[model samples]
Target: MLAGKRILLIIAAGIAAYKSLDLIRRLRERGVSVTPVLTRAAEEFVTPLSVSALAGEEAHRDLFDLTKEAEMGHIQLSRVADLVVVAPATADLMAKMAGGQADDLASTLLMATDTPVLIAPAMNVRMWEHPATQRNLATLQGDGVAVVGPNSGDMACGEHGPGRMAEPLEIVAAIEARLASGPLAGRRIVVTSGPTHEPIDPVRYIANRSSGAQGTAIARALVALGAEVVFVTGPAEVPPPEGVTLVKVQTARQMHDAVMAALPADAGVFAAAVADWRVAKEATSKMKKTAGGLPVLEFAENPDILKAVAGLEDSRPALVIGFAAETDDVIRHATEKRARKGCDWILANDVSAGTGIMGGTENAIVLISDAGAEEWPRMTKTEVASRLARRIAEALEAG
Candidate 1:
């Protein structure tokens, strides 16, 4: 969809300004053309030459260059692009944008352009969390501007909470999403994510290493594609993406209930690594240590959420997809799971130790359907989510 798209890239001043280079490269690799605009403060962090080299076009910096304005005016510049993206959106810049203060070129263009604006905020944790920033964010959202992330992580300033800029790859993905046309604009999608916890006692529980990255990405991707998303997640380290309804859960049964309550949707992506078995009877108090022998646990099967939804006659989604995380015979297990669960499609992946795929960043998946199994190469979870989302859109169009 982005083959000939024109993107106006605006870089704001911050330590995270360096990531805009990779963001430019990723967009160009996707055959999208970029025109760079750097704030005066942005010049302190990265050179115009470096940005221009990566963008393959001249960088626009000054708002008051008489000769440059004559050649290509700000009005002309703002009218040409299909979308405008601001990376490392600083606290100062966002405040000005929200307040309609256009003292600079970038802010002036943003105000002049009818083009949709997307921002990825990067600042200190304190600045991001301040009530003033929150108010500004609310104003932006109310004005229909898209905000991506200021993810929580270790910061360059040596303090950590929220307010680190999203990675370059993530920014690229966000742009792709913004450019995507919403065939499912009015539709609703419900997705389940992460590994469910089955409690053993007060202090202990059984769980898997599913990081919920894939599921969270799917929810964000669906939102990008214009679907209202309800993200049901288990205990996951990564926070849910912005602009979506979030349902947090801890156990398989809780996830099942959430999915069921959020149903009658257009699609369902069952990406959660729900525990198949759970303790039949949970111990109310902490279990004491056994001195002579190993303690035995009674087990029971958890509710089959996918199957239940697929079997629904009235409230079932148009498409129901399930996931199979297998160690051996991945495709075979996935195929069996599809038939047994009565799902429309099954995504199978090998989760062996040392693969780093379980809770890691990248994945290799085999998509199994009634027709056949299609193997996909190893890629980041975001990439996988994008391809899957497109495939889902194609399938819906075909149907």
Candidate 2:
């Protein structure tokens, strides 16, 4: 899909810099021309000769090279590529980009570029979790930068956490998604996934059987169609898909706040199974079995996320979709829910005792809208997600 596209790859300083060599080969195999740029510190990890050899182009190093500057000015070079990627983006480099510092060639080119930017960050565990680095990441995202991964695993520093750069193939997928020209190309979407947990005590909580497979698949499909997705997920059984701005929350209130913060989107898919109520006064410590009778807990209603978003007069999404997991009277309840919530569409499903659809791979959906009910055949969750994504794209285009 990315054939004939040109990429300007900036390799920053880190142990993960070695992965860029394979990344260049992967891009070339897909008919993508890669122009490599190496930072001064990056030379210590991977040589310019190796990068140049794999890319089949001379690696650009110095910002002050007289001959290269005369051949191609920095401003012109930056604007010539279809996209610019920074692999193994160190914490320092990210801070520089966020702060708009152009002291070196890589930062200068980034500051001058009009093309979309994608970064795969690599740093120590502590550095990745640090407040400063997180602030810089948020700033870059606000400036329209795309991020792939800083996946959790073993780090070179002998520490283990979310500070590793994404694999070469994962980076390739993100690049393709960023460059796609499909129907949803310039749209920004918000998707909520998984079941929210409401604490009963320090260790006990209330949740559901939602696995989040459908929501995750939907987000992936939207990304493939070129929509920038803000994925707000709870503690789900499945990991989030690549190529999305992920926001993790635990409680219903937290999920509601995150969804609200991601507003002004083109559309919203509310698939999360949030708890209806929470303990009114949670115990500070774990409740123990004592001679005293079982403690009675008071419950308070949780925020109605879908209703609030749908009722918004301003900064509301053009299209709002909600999900209903029903055990009885599916059509009647879901249709009533659509009217009560004031959402554009509702995807209702039966999760009765023998259905095996709640935590299973398959889904049987009943789509409800103003035009009335449309029953779909039972299929895999992934298939349902793809179909839903196409429908969403068509809806936006019609508007």
Candidate 3:
């Protein structure tokens, strides 16, 4: 899967530069081409000669090397690669990236490159814990920058909690995941994510605790498998992945309309936890606090998106998947939901508080269909999405 793929490796200022050398060697062993770039501070730790010798390519260090610029300018250098990896992504470089600063070659290449980026951060535990660092991390993640890890263990410094760079093998796995393509190529799919907002007032709305992690991961996985994904999302905590058609919506009705408009797809994965009801009559103006007693509000059923799409005789997706978040009788409820909604499958999960499935990073899902209910053990939302995407690909290939 890694053969002939080009990786632009950016070595930032950190004590973990040694790890990056091993990273380059590992990439080369997997038949991947590595182009190394070293920041000025990176040179303090690892020599350019060593980096170039390991990579078997000249290490690019300056943003404005007049000779290289004349040959292949910075813009060309940035665009020529399939992916860019930032190793030993120190706090300062991360902050700079979050702020879109292009003061150095590494930062400028990151800003200039359209290729996907994966960062491996390494720093002091205290620096990693800083709110500023956390905010920076969030910003980068939201902008679709992939991160490997700062695995927890003893750091270069005396104190340790987190902030060690991930092992070379782990990083290689992440790279392989990013570059891998599958049978889903040339297929188009639609995925809905996040909890739909039901407006009670202009400023206030009723929403569930869905953080949209699973749906977003599903979309990312689909994209990785060479699928053209239409991602329809409501207010989601995580940002949509790069290289997809993103449609943002606010309410369940809006989400439904968006999904329907992106129709004639290979599949439709309705993972959104849409609200069942909305205010019967939304006030044209914000209702003010009055001396009168409490106002009586009415409720109206929101549009049933899953049923509408699945029941369509002419334009239904070949594979329709709905999500059932049940607290009790999970399989029974999901089975009923699949039948009622006319969807091909229903992925059921327990959203009961203790499960921590809802709005959390991990998911324990049950895949229910006409065949039977297959129980899947607890796994990360990303793993679940990847497995689901692969299943969809297999089903489509068979069909």
In candidate 3, the residue pairs with backbone N, CA or C atoms under 3 Å apart (3 or more residues apart, or in different chains) clash, namely none
For 1-399, candidate 1 gives per-residue lDDT tens digits of 578999999999999999999889988988889999999999999999999999899999998889878876887778799889999899998998899999989999988888888888999999987989977876775565766676667999999876888877766666666666687555667899988999988878888778889999998888777765667889987887755555668899989987875666778999998998999888989998778788799999999999999999987888999999999989888999999999999999999888889888999999999789999999999999999988887787777
Candidate 3 lDDT trough over 10 residues, lowest sum = 173-182
TM-score of candidate 3 relative to the true fold: 0.57
After TM-score superposition, what is the CA distance of residue 222 in candidate 3 from its true location, in Å? 1.0
TM-scores across all candidates? 0.57, 0.81, 0.57
Per-model CA lDDT versus the true structure? 0.86, 0.91, 0.86
Best-performing candidate as measured by TM-score: 2
How well is each residue in 181-256 modelled by candidate 2, as lDDT tens digits? 8888878889999999999888999887789999999999899889978789998999988767677788999999
Task: Give candidate 2 misplaced runs (Cα > 4 Å).
Answer: 14-22, 28-31, 90-100, 123-139, 152-164, 198-204, 238-264, 278-288, 295-304, 307-315, 339-342, 370-373
Of models 1 and 3, which has the larger lDDT?
3
TM-score-based ranking? 2, 1, 3
Q: For model 2, where is the 10-residue window of minimal lDDT? A: 68-77
